[model samples]
Target: MKHLKIIALLLRNSLMSHLEYRFSFIMWSITSILWIMLTLISIEFIFGHVNSIAGWTKNQMLLIATVFGIFSSIMWMFFLPSAINITKLVRKGTLDFYLLKPIGNRFLLSTNQFSLDNFPRACILVLIMFGLIDSMGLKISFLSWIQFILFLLIGLGIFYNIFFTAAVTSIWFIDIFNLEDLYANILNVGRLPTHIFEGFTKLSFMFILPVMFVATFPAQILLGTADITMAITGLVILIQDLRGKSMNFLGFSH
Candidate 1:
């Protein structure tokens, strides 16, 4: 309950701060929507030439793009800002302030920063997803919905762990900037169907890097073709990553 209250307070503060700069917030929203539109236009153009890519129909590809957009929005809103901020804090030697606080340093560092600008992107992506489902005539069962939600959470966990672990490495290598750009490029790959890859590339994306798990698995679940073994493998990876990172973060905090 205490942790929940802290998170609520952080969110309230973040919203209030962003509200003070209403023009900037509005400009961010406009640019974000424009970018999303351009992305969708590119996808439409691709499908205009080819009926399907890697056996994925236009609607299926759109669904994957929509899912990736949703995941990207959430990551930008909550995780990316904090991850970048941690790097800055570490570089400036101000992370000790968080360490000195009574709250857990991991919680403080991860939750202190928020990007309210991405909220609109998240909403738009969700609406797009629903429209795609309707157009595709997908009859998703309740169990599938539950499974999709679970996999989405697992995807978020996996991403957060990988991202934060990279950020935390700033403690040892302060010059390791541009991690965000590197990860962003990797995430862009998730916009396509995992079926497009073959052999080693597919194996790397499935286990080594696992960017496909971030969006592909959830989209597959919606399409009623999700691989249960793949989902279980992702969950296990997430658990192990979290376990290892928690200990590392605790050591860093002290």
Candidate 2:
């Protein structure tokens, strides 16, 4: 209950801060929507020439793209602004202020900068994915819906793990400006089907990059063709990262 109140307070303050600059918010919204359109165009460009890159139809790949957009938007909307920026704050000593507060540092840092403005992209992507799923006439069941919800949660966990790992990496390399870009590029690869890759490429993405689990695996599960091994590997990575002995997971511990 106390934690809930703190979250509510954080959200209220964040919303207040966002509304302080209405024009900037509007411009951001415009650019965000345009970027989504561009993303869809890029997907179309790839599918336009190739009859089928990896046996996935245009709609199937679009579905993956839509899910990726939603995942990306969620990162922007919450994870990046609030938690991922903590590294900069730490380097600047701004985090000292957070440390002095009463709330748990992790919770406060995680929720401090929730951007209501950036949520529209996620909303749009979800709607687009739903529309594509319906148009494709894929038969979905209650069990599949449950699995999809689970996959979404796990995808968010994967996002959280990646972003947190990047931020935590700042404990060692504080001036890495392209940290988010690294994550973005990895996730962008997931916009296409995993099967598009041949031999070693498939193995590399499924394990090293793990982007396939974030978008492709979830879409596959929904489409009734998920690779159980990939899904398990992603989940295991997430769990290990969360409970690992790494400095990031251990919170700057020695």
Candidate 3:
């Protein structure tokens, strides 16, 4: 209960900070929208030349874009901020400040900061996704909705483990700033359906790198195209990876 209150206070303070700088906040929001629009327009240009990319229809692709946006916004909302804080805290050896606090290290690190800008963008993308789905007349069942939510949770779990592991690794490699962009780049690959790639590349993304968890599997669930066996396998592999990586991080931290 105390931790919840602390997180709530932090979120309120973060959003209020943005309101304190209205023009910059507004301009930043606008910039974000324009970039999203540009991506959509580029998709439009591509479809102008062909009926579809890979096996995905235009409406399906739009849904993929929507799913991608959800994943991206999540990164910005929680994972990005926490990973960044950990990196800086580790590098400056300022992590001890939080350690000395009453809060648990994980709790303090996870809820220390957030960018309120991402919340509105996530809501907008969700609204746009539903609107696009409506326009496309995609018939989604109740079961599919359940699957979508489940897979989304699984993806977020994978996302946290992946980026948090990277941040922990920075304790040993303090000078590398590019590790910051690593998560974002991985998320970018999720902007398209996995079917678009063939042979080894697709397998690498789906299993080895597991970028598919960030967007593809959830998108498949939303679109009612999910393969249950594959989805279950993905979740299992992620769980195993999480178990293994937790030990790896503990090994490094201690």
Top lDDT prediction, candidate number: 1
Model 1 lDDT tens row, 90-131: 888998888889877778888989999999988998999999
Candidate 1 Cα outliers beyond 4 Å, as residue runs: 246-250
lDDT, ranked from best to worst: 1, 3, 2
- Model 3 ranges off by over 4 Å: 244-248, 251-254
Give TM per candidate. Answer: 0.95, 0.88, 0.92
**lDDT of all predictions, in order shown?**
0.85, 0.75, 0.79
lDDT of 2 at 235: 72
Clashing pairs in 2: none
lDDT of 2 by residue, 1-254 (tens): 99888778877887788789988888988888999899789878987788666788788888888887787777777777765577778788787787678766666667777777877777888889889989999888999888877877777766676676667667668776766677677667877777878888987777666667668887987789887776886678667755543334646422
Backbone clashes, each candidate: 0, 0, 0
lDDT, candidate 3, equals 0.79
List, residue by residue over 66-160, the lDDT tens digit for candidate 3: 88898888778876797778878987889779767876666677778787787777888889889988998878899888888787877787777
RMSD of each: 1.7, 2.6, 2.1
